[model samples]
Target: MNESWMNEVSARLASLAAANPARDFEKNARGLLSSAFARLDLVTREEFDVQSQVLARAREKLAALEARVAELEATAAGRVK
Candidate 1:
């Protein structure tokens, strides 16, 4: 939110751009932009890790449901025999 902080970031990015002569300028610029945006408080790696674990559990539950559906279908077809 502070203009001075933004200016400082801009200056640092400019320095990075000048120093990295062998890298892609656009990619480096985008990375700098991302870093600046990330300066604001955001989710930490630990929080993201927790969410990833939750998603994995949900996916496992979904797979079990799909397998159960297949088994039910098989049972229903057999009953029609």
Candidate 2:
């Protein structure tokens, strides 16, 4: 039904692209995009997620350390009173 129609259209398009200059244009476009992307600083989703988790853990540890320091300072001030 609809699936067979799509398959036939895809086959026709593939045949036309193979025999046409469109194939070379598509290749050149992909190469240009890849070159541009390579020139930019970028991270994969997995790397970004890992770094985000690391930063979150560091923040939590920093908060705990700050609380500990505040408690120690208060205890010292009470003794000095």
Candidate 3:
């Protein structure tokens, strides 16, 4: 929803910029920055946050597994001793 509004505004701004000589430099600079950013293949902030949450969950799982392994190893060692 927000993305749609942003795209709409960007389109309108581009159209207005086309005939505005005063903003020629700003327009060119904006064009260059956008293209450069596009080429970088960056993800949106929302996507990053989602991935961060996933990674955190994964880390929690890993820690639990590690602890279980340690407990199992300790039990086995006690039996041998």
Candidate 4:
């Protein structure tokens, strides 16, 4: 985190705050800070959504495999009896 870069960011933020005078400046500033920190921290919404879909598909496939396994086990049990 370079001091110059921070200064640049601060300048840009000040410009933004000045531009939106009608809004609650402090709240908006906090929100912007939070968003920037979140961006720095990983796990964006798009990536999360993609992983969620993948997990759902995996769960569905697991359910189907479980059902098939149960059927096979039942069939084998019947033959043994």
Candidate 5:
């Protein structure tokens, strides 16, 4: 009976010790990584959307220029013929 009581007391002490902040490795690592990522100059969704729109406009302009070049090339070829 005494041995069983000692085991129960030791288990309770261990449970309390385990609750210390120093033992929270997973939470600490996650917080550290979150802070690291936040330090980076990452864009928000609104900024990404604005950049996407800019890229789309650039693509459209490139397509128009390509079509214009093709038309000019065809006209030049016809003149040569």
Candidate 6:
């Protein structure tokens, strides 16, 4: 019986706290921060990760092309000699 009473009291306290001004302040602060963050240019982690992968692939291709060009230049030089 005592445990049940304590639980009920705790629940009422929680319900009251939820309606308190501090809760409203917290909600308003969260909204303000969300609005400010939304106004800035930002990419999601998924987008940043995808773009990083794309850049890595592009770098690999460029390196392969450079190596191929160097190999061709060497072959051309050997032929001239």
Give the deviation of candidate 2 from the true structure as CA RMSD: 9.3
Model 6: weakest 10-residue lDDT segment is 8-17
Candidate 4 local lDDT, 1-81, one digit each (tens): 667857866986888778777467777778777876775667889999999999999999999999999999999999999
* Candidate 5 local lDDT, 1-81, one digit each (tens): 357755755565465557756556456556655665576668899999999999999999999999999999999999999
Misplaced by over 4 Å in model 6 are 1-20
Segments of candidate 3 deviating more than 4 angstroms: 1-20
lDDT of 3 by residue, 9-78 (tens): 5775676677677568477657756875676689999999999999999999999999999999999999
Candidate with top TM-score is 2
Q: After superposition, how far is residue 21 of candidate 2 from its true place, in Å?
A: 2.0
Ranking by TM-score: 2, 3, 6, 5, 4, 1
Steric clashes per prediction: 0, 0, 0, 0, 0, 0
Summarize candidate 2's per-residue lDDT along 23-45 as a digit string, tens digits. Answer: 67577556655665565668899
Candidate 4 accuracy as lDDT: 0.83
Pick by lDDT: 2 or 3, better one: 3
Better candidate number, 5 or 6, judged by lDDT = 6
Worst 10 residues of 5 by lDDT: 20-29
Please provide, for model 1 over 10-78, each residue's C-alpha lDDT reduced to its tens digit, 9 standing for 90 to 100.
Answer: 897788778877467677888877887788868989999999999999999999999999999999999
Q: List the residue pairs that clash in candidate 4.
A: none
Against the true structure, what is each candidate's TM-score?
0.51, 0.72, 0.64, 0.52, 0.57, 0.62
Show the lowest summed lDDT stretch of 10 residues, model 4. Answer: 32-41
The model with the greater lDDT, 3 or 6, is 3
The CA lDDT of each predicted structure is: 0.87, 0.77, 0.80, 0.83, 0.74, 0.76
User: Residue-wise lDDT of candidate 6 within 5-81, one digit each (tens)?
Assistant: 55755565566557768877567556655665575667899999999999999999999999999999999999999
